[model samples]
Target: MSHFIKQNDPSDLFFPGGLFLNSDTFPTSFFSLFPSSSSSSKASTVSCFSWGPTSRTKVVSVFSVIGGGGGGDFLSLSLSFNSRSNEDHQKHGRESRENVEQHEKKKVCEEEEKENNNVGLVSHGSGAINMTKHLWAGAVAAMVSRTFVAPLERLKLEYIVRGEQRNLFELIQAIATSQGLKGFWKGNFVNILRTAPFKAINFYAYDTYRNKLTRMMGNEESTNFERFVAGAAAGITATLLCLPMDTIRTVMVAPGGEALGGIVGALRHVIKTEGFFSLYKGLVPSIISMAPSGAVFYGVYDILKTAYLHSPEGMKRIEHMKEEDQGLNALEQLELGPFRTLLYGAIAGCCSEAATYPFEVIRRQLQMQVSTTRMNAMATCVKIVEQGGVPALYAGLTPSLLQVLPSAAISYLVYEFMKIVLKVESS
Candidate 1:
């Protein structure tokens, strides 16, 4: 780090003019001729006359200066045609290269800043090292997010299963009336246990596939179409891996009084009661929903990051820095600017969630309905609509929207921070 301070001294002003000027062009006697307070106190003037052996043109120059008060001496710096030659051109090239190298070195100094500029698709393998680091970071973040929402997730399951509309307050009241205050979080422990690892697998697989597919298409940089495909792949992979867990959580969260002892118990109960395929009742809708939902979530984030980096203000900020000091590409810039990235991610997730809420409603109902019913996701959706109108398919939309905004934002923000931390620690 370099600290630069301004020096205040009259002599400092003379250093540049003396070093560059020729004695013939600006003689010592000229300084004496400069206007003092006694000569001129009102204004400054300049008159130029040239005369010498090379006097193709003779010019005489005169300048007036006002002393005291606020006015002070002014120094002029300019490069005339005579000053620039082949030698200067060569010098300029050397200086430019030095600046480039300096910029590269400075960027290396701030590894964290560099990390912030990185924008990785859920897909696209940067390299083995980054792949592992990103995967672990995403997995850990997913677990944290899921853990926090376990109780609400359980309540959502119950509400969906009962086919009822209940606001948060009423929902809490209902839970307390039937199962005590603890009932509000009836299956939360199991929900967390189920979703934490479940979400890890979900995000990991989604990103992995998304990256690979885009790479195959020669779009590892990932276009909008590519992002949609990548998000969809990741979502589907994750949804598949965790389908069984999804079923278990739904049942446990349902209004039923049966307290399945553990994950093993829950699985056993579902299989024994409703047959093996029952565990995947909502699989189709979930798979269908995951693709677009995931695509939109990540795609919107990328677009936001891209827009932020390209903005006028963003460009000015980068311009002020030494190119090497500002070690961020468009994507990397947003990572550095986490709040902007977060806003993008939040908006994207909310939009995705809202768009697919109908599918979500069907998936929830299929998973929670439990017995004597082999309802396909499509059939479930149709039934909900026919019975309770379109809004039935978006029963818990308020809560869903509420949960998504912050959860998605925090996940992305923390992910970016973690990347910075990892880069610093590793370096």
Candidate 2:
């Protein structure tokens, strides 16, 4: 195969929605390095791989601003591979082995480009656009579903504090009898506030880190391990950022006079009685589960997105469409924007919560104790296991599933719609 680099002005490419072209777009330099292929070869291969989140971010932004954007590149690239010959396959394999060295060179080039672009005042107004969209969506969704979260949390707490195995109906009745209908929303506002920002920051951080790391590693693609680190880091950061809010939310949600009174009262009670550190109860388990959950959720979403956008049928349709209708038209785009993000968020939330549901039980128990001396999170886990039996770790799993499935779905859907509406008005 013969290789060549194709460079072009950004204006030469189709402007999907006619948005701002930053400094990089003017007199832009992009490498479309292609491998050379010998004619008469039964099978030929051309693999164009780019590391870093630039393309991903671009697509997301396109979708956010214009209603629809280009789908994941890898998905399309994979489809191209189906027609490759044996010789092409071998060549591709050889190149894959040297992917690391090629990546290092690419990184240097990207860094230089970034520095130069910055000097020219190329503002990334579009930077973090997707992140913002996700954040707003998440916050709105969380707010809409606050009641569900509160009730599930309440049931989970009751199972831990009162040793009750009550059904949802029973739990609802019990909570109503004790705290009234308003009790269902206890600590809800706090949860919405905390979860929205937490989800936004954590999700964006993971994407940012993963892209940067993949680019540095010289890998043409993000490896699972890299994704894991990114997800884990984001999860930890989010947990820490929202820890105080979580503590307050949890205290308020749990049924106890000391915690129920107000934020000030809760703060004083935890400080004067349980000590300042009590605010971080159940932190460990939360951190542990968050990372993998994020990795799986985002990674899977990326993969699926890639596949969908690149499928032969999908590509054919896109290529065949008129310029105006080629990408996503306004109405088509609007219809999909909110629902897609909503589905993505819901899937991530449910999968993550399910994987960590047991830990959720343990954390609530630890927090509800109103007292504990263990400095480490692991010790708390051990203590809970020894005292409550292994089964106790999942006491409220039912309620969690009940609440999370619909709540997440509703929250994400509403969030996406709200974001689109806001974008429409802003535009």
Best by TM-score: 1
* Candidate 2: 10-residue stretch with minimal lDDT: 59-68
TM-score of model number 1: 0.61
Angstrom error at residue 391, model 2 = 1.6
Model 1 weakest lDDT span, ten residues long? 1-10
lDDT of 2 by residue, 127-176 (tens): 44645665665566566766556777666556765678667688789779
For model 1, how does the per-residue alpha-carbon lDDT over 1-427 read when each residue is reduced to its tens digit? Answer: 0011122543453444322222233454654565454544423455655443422233344544323233233333323332334456557678878999999989887785556555343224455566567656665666666556555655666556775566788876777788776665566666556565655555556556656666788863657777777677878877877788778877765655367866788889889988998888788899888888888887787677667657887777556544545565434443336667568768987999998888888887777775766677768778888998987888877777777777787677666665555551221
Which pairs clash in the backbone of model 2? 1-36, 1-37, 2-35, 2-36, 2-37, 3-36, 103-218, 141-411
Model 1 spans with C-alpha error above 4 angstroms: 1-132, 176-185, 205-210, 315-336, 424-427
| RMSD over all Cα atoms, model 2 | 30.2
